[model samples]
Target chain A: MANIKIIQGDFQQRLKLQFAPGIKAGFPSPADDYSHETLDFNRDLILNPEATFYGKVEGDSMIEAGICDGDIAVIDRSIEPRDGDVVVGYINDEFTIKYLDLRHRKDGYIELRPANNDFKPIRIREDDDFEVWGVVVWTIKNWRKY
Target chain B: MYGIIDCDNCYVSCERVFRPDLKDKPVVVLSNNDGCVVARSNEAKKMGIKAGTPYFQLAEQFPNQKIAVFSSNYELYGELTGRVVEIIRQEAPAYFRYSIDECFVCFDGFADTNLKEWGENLHKRILRSVGMPVSIGIAPTKTLAKMASHFAKKYEGYRHCCMIDTDEKRIKALKLYPIGEVWGIGRRYAARLEALGVKTAFDLANHNETWVKATFNNIVIERTWRELNGIDCVPNEEMAKKKSICTSRSFNGMITDLDGLRTHVSNHAARCAEKLRQQGTVATIVGVFLNTNAFREDLPQRCSFQETLLTNPSNSTITIVKAANEVLQKLYRQGYHYKKAGVIVMGIGPDSPYQPDLFDFNAEQFEKMKRLDAVVDRINKVNGTASIVLGSQQYTRKNGKGKADVVARSARRDACQSKNAIKQDFKSKNPTTRWSDIITLK
Candidate 1:
């Protein structure tokens, strides 16, 4: 039988040592063909070339879109989001999905308005700070039966 | 062109695959044992059958009509759907399951390839391989594709394939189809739009975006309007994980005994905990509830709910069910035939982000118990559900005989062989087990 003992001393060093070939047996490794770290590391490589990876969408404002509480959206980096496009954008390190309100303000400001009435439009603080991850080329929603 | 393929008469098709004798017949799958019409075939609908019509009502309407009705066979439907989607995934570079019956496939930049031919191939493949007929709709936008798919399903001679990519084709299709038939427009919204003189898809498309947005300020509605105009406003997501995991089911019969209630609650808690584990989240609160059939006035009715906080957030079934039992007792009252007993685990957080409890038991006993529970769960999952259950469940089921008998008559007409029912019927009355006897006590 294989030893299933968990060792949690100096995790960084232990993880680094385990990366070496012919490392000693018995570590807190997940039970899979590939280690947890290996899968996390390969996530970048496994991404669809045509698709852009936008992290989790936060808020129930767009629940009618079937994009509920916590859902990760994929946007096509190539497609230019037109009017009414569901775009993933960054506003002060926070990511959100909303209809692109391209109408520039008279005061030299741009805003992205949420579909739900509960949330306010995210006003562009600085032109340099705002970065659109990608235009949402398609939306994949959940099929919850219950 | 984007293609949307929808399964035709899904529940009836699923049933027909198993019972081939019912092919091309007017079949209607009932919600639960001739309760109401949940799924009906094209043949049944032509015979003036309606969805959600009470089975008794349908029987009255079609006294001479041959209607092969069957209870909803979820296992077969789920299994067949898995097979169909597998065939789809094998065919398309990218695919999205819009619903159980419908899936959208990307044929992006198919400049030279014959799109209609491709759709026909997929339709025939699904029909031949899975024993189910599917209609395909191809259009410039997903919304139009969905609309066209519905038309293809309703109409004959479309040869299971319909396309509306060009303006001429789209106009012809829209003129013939109703405005409410569009993917996102529902009855109330359609009525409002119709009140505004927008009676068809062509009229809706002819209206400016400003007016549409003014009427429907929600973002999804605006996207729907855009999609109607041939713009892909909604993007595709590769991985969409579940937000909340719930495990609940109405019991075959009402359970009055406290032990039986606890057993059902434990079972639900365990199932929900497993779901949480599958999603890589740990629930901090377990909500347990019990309710009686509100329609039944013969018995005293009661409904109660209790949410218990966990010391350490976990997805372990043992830990969750222990919490569920505590809530079950607090909610349980005397003399109520409970139709449903359920547990909903919420306040989910990432497993790695949890702060470990200080001054918690690190005793060897606790560690051993966890390891044992893990082993049991692994065995149960691999073998079958309830292949190995807690002793409490066995004791609880023993005490539930009186309540089970009340609903046993209605349950037995299904012509299904439930393993537990056989075991329950065979067991000698009042048979008991002694713990010491296992060791050959003399």
Candidate 2:
């Protein structure tokens, strides 16, 4: 029995410390029945872990839409892009963040509308090699500026 | 029923995820050290780009063709494939990853379900979520499911999902499948089977058990025959116990000294030990292999491998690294330029409650080693990989551009890197894993 030891599931082991949650501290609190896990961005906010990707915003492409440079965009490829949705599109060998404007579908071409007035709208003639790479689900901004 | 989902052209497909422009283009990914083509896209396959074609020969053979080339980036491949596996984890009733690109699922209770539609929808979901195209195969046994996946990849009519549910379908699939391609029937057995006038899976399945037993007395071949005849004989334990862990790398350049070779072997040995501990296993043997580049015909060529048995099977990095260095000392030749080297840990089994020899059992030291290893594993996980590597594992590395952020702690840190850092000149960005390399949206 010299070589006996614990094995398997070594990663999920936790410290055997005791603050004693079961000690009935302060009358067990009134909200004990409804206690649950806290909200985590990785688990709750991101619905599709497989399809989620992140991109850093640049060039003030969507500045008027409150999506500024240095912000992080959470893109979900599994989501369907709809009219007035902020989406990432690949064009001219780069990813451009823009609003998907499908209101002109009867005119035989859709447009990638920009949020800032300084930038012009990019239109497709229905013959171009183009696709909306992913839809923007959320954007995180750093207000404190580290 | 059993289902196998295999990533189509796995490494090349991983490379194409970030670069959507590479779609419909001829692309191939090279092995470590930019050695040779290990993966080829369908378009590249159509252009007759064979796997294992050396890097230099690609330009010579296809003079005027436009083909995309990539160095194998396992970080990207592993991350992307992990996403695919995550989707499978959500969709499949029960599954286990067979390899990096293949996953086996047991559809035990879904008797009334439409497996074909289920497989098709699974494929669609994976492709949609991960941008990875996978082929699905469903059958009564694992072997037949693997064979069906091949048909799903070959013919478009299967819609990336093939099922061998009926006897007629199984018989037809067996007839069309070549003998050499059958699972568990390796090359040696395939040659023996072909010599006996058995050329297809159907040929082996059609023979009676007495003939199979009389012809080949091997149990593995017999199991293949039985599985081909619709018997489920493959065990999950065979998949669970990896049996061996091999870590090898072709150097960026050849090495002529024993010291440099020792560093490479120690790194590989340490890697093998880490892998063993991660899987909660221990290895009873430590093997080392050294070889010269066969392509350099002008120079002398030599290749050899030798292993040493341990007094006690161990997964400790120091123990394995020391054993590997001892073997390397015997295997090394003074004047040969070694191009590649590797360490293999075999005879692997569960680490808990191992038997110890009466003469070599040291209980106190074993406890110390376990505590040390656990702390090292934790430190490496938090600070980043290889942060507290063994002294023997330390080697000065070439500063490949864009990777100049080596921690500055000592004079050794500032010293130039070892000459044999792997040559991955065409490795793409790790946009998915690294924050500094994430995609830029304009």
Candidate 3:
């Protein structure tokens, strides 16, 4: 019963943060004028605004892939899911984040491999209702905010 | 060539995006107020469920079958439609959104390219991007393109894209396409054409142009005949400004009180004004109508309508709501259970550089109102609808109370909140538009 709700991202009010030069532990270098260029996070991260969707991770099955519980997964439907790519897939009408394995695809079946060793690889039968919803482009975890 | 990309079972497809479990199951989307079936999945269609069939009839029709039913969620469908349109805009050189579920694209420069392959890629791109299946039909004319789209949807062999590029293919396609199924031809014209031995599109194309023109005496049918013959008679439809705008809805339950009716009327009026501003148009006339349920024979039925002409055209929500409220007051009748109310703004024209009123001219007041409307529209657009509405439109419902008591409490609350209060019970979430409804995994 996990329904993915997609909200449109506001691109007009983009925040551009200045990338200040890093300070070394050995010595602190003078701030360079070249480091004043600001970066637009939305432009850098989101390749396709219309096709990109954000979903929160629920289970720990994909913890090995750095997509832990409560992490936000950026799924891009525009990008084709390649073999071994982390993908958000719909199986039996439920969404699951897993590694897509195409090695055994020629045998007329696909495999959804969970990142965590605790979970077993799911063998997708030809008769099973399944689809690759999108490729997980990025994952954002709230390290210290929470 | 013009290509039409139409989402297959649009409303059903939208619902499936959220509830994939509905796949391979009989699903039906009900119309407003959960009255009748507005859309049905392929399985539902196979089960003999028809569009506009009353929701109550489903049980009688399929006694033992499991069926998934959903009320019309326009907010979700509208957002998904926008996403689909955005994808189309990026893929096609130029496009016209024909409707919520369909778009017409022109392939002007890519004449020598592999059109069939291009169509397939477009189909796959939309499906992958939006999770909605679309059928594409490419032809020399819009009418023919529409006909080709029908074939693309009907036959699986087409692989969701059917292109009629050559004259031979055009003739063959037209031969199989019925006159009734042609783009612009309605039932009346279809019957008349069939009586005149025009059973198929091929037959219509074979007739003499002069004879067809003299027989039908309609420019639209003439254009269709020309289009069937591989001539692009219908140009790309331009987005034209509307002459009038209306916002109306049938309530979930009947209301007998005048204040209750006023709430819905003001809401409709505000929507009409918002639409006018969206289109950069102003209305010179405002109309309001209220009607009792026609199906309730046991109750006394009454219907009334009234309109007011403004001295100066305006797109202001306050002005429109005031006019609508005045008309609603005039149309209101006691001892009637009103089932529906509506507001319409007519005499629409360009909003800018309007002629001021001769007797009553107030520039400062108009400026202030315009600024207020702009702020309200911006807030509502960014925060989802009803972030701010007319004070008269506020309504409240008491929780944990009996039906009769709840109604009485709501009436009292409405009277007190009419000055200024915000109360809403929007059961359906605007997931795409509202930040609060965004999905969170638990």
User: Which prediction has the highest TM-score against the true structure?
Assistant: 2
lDDT of 1 by residue, B311-376 (tens): 888887778888989999889898889887778888887766657677774547545865776787
- Report the lDDT tens digits of candidate 3 across residue range B1-442: 8899999999889878756677789888887667678899999999899999977898998899998888788788888888999988887888988778998888888544888998898888888887889999999999999999999999999999999999998989999989999998999999999999889999999999999989989998998999988888776633346667888877766888887788789989999999899878999999998989999999999888889998889999999999999999889888999888899999998898888987797899999999999999998877657767776665544342322333432554553344223222222455455545543432
Clashes of each: 7, 4, 0
Off by over 4 Å in 2: A1-34, B396-417
Per-candidate local distance difference test: 0.68, 0.88, 0.82
Estimate, for each residue in A1-146, the C-alpha lDDT of model 3 and write its tens digit.
99998854544545655444464355545655544334455787888877777777888898887779888778888887899998887765457888999888778898999889999998997777777777888888787975
**Candidate 2 displacement at residue B199 in angstroms:** 1.8
Q: TM per model?
A: 0.57, 0.91, 0.82
- Alpha-carbon deviation at B356 in model 1, angstroms: 8.1
Ranking by TM-score: 2, 3, 1
Clashing residue pairs in candidate 2, if any?
A: B396-B417, B396-B418, B397-B417, B397-B418
What digit string (tens of lDDT, one per residue) describes model 2 on residues B253-282? Answer: 789978678878998999999999988999
- Model 2 Cα displacement at B71 (Å)? 1.2
Candidate 1: lDDT over CA atoms?
0.68
Each candidate's DockQ score against the native complex? Answer: 0.01, 0.59, 0.34
lDDT of 3 at B276: 94
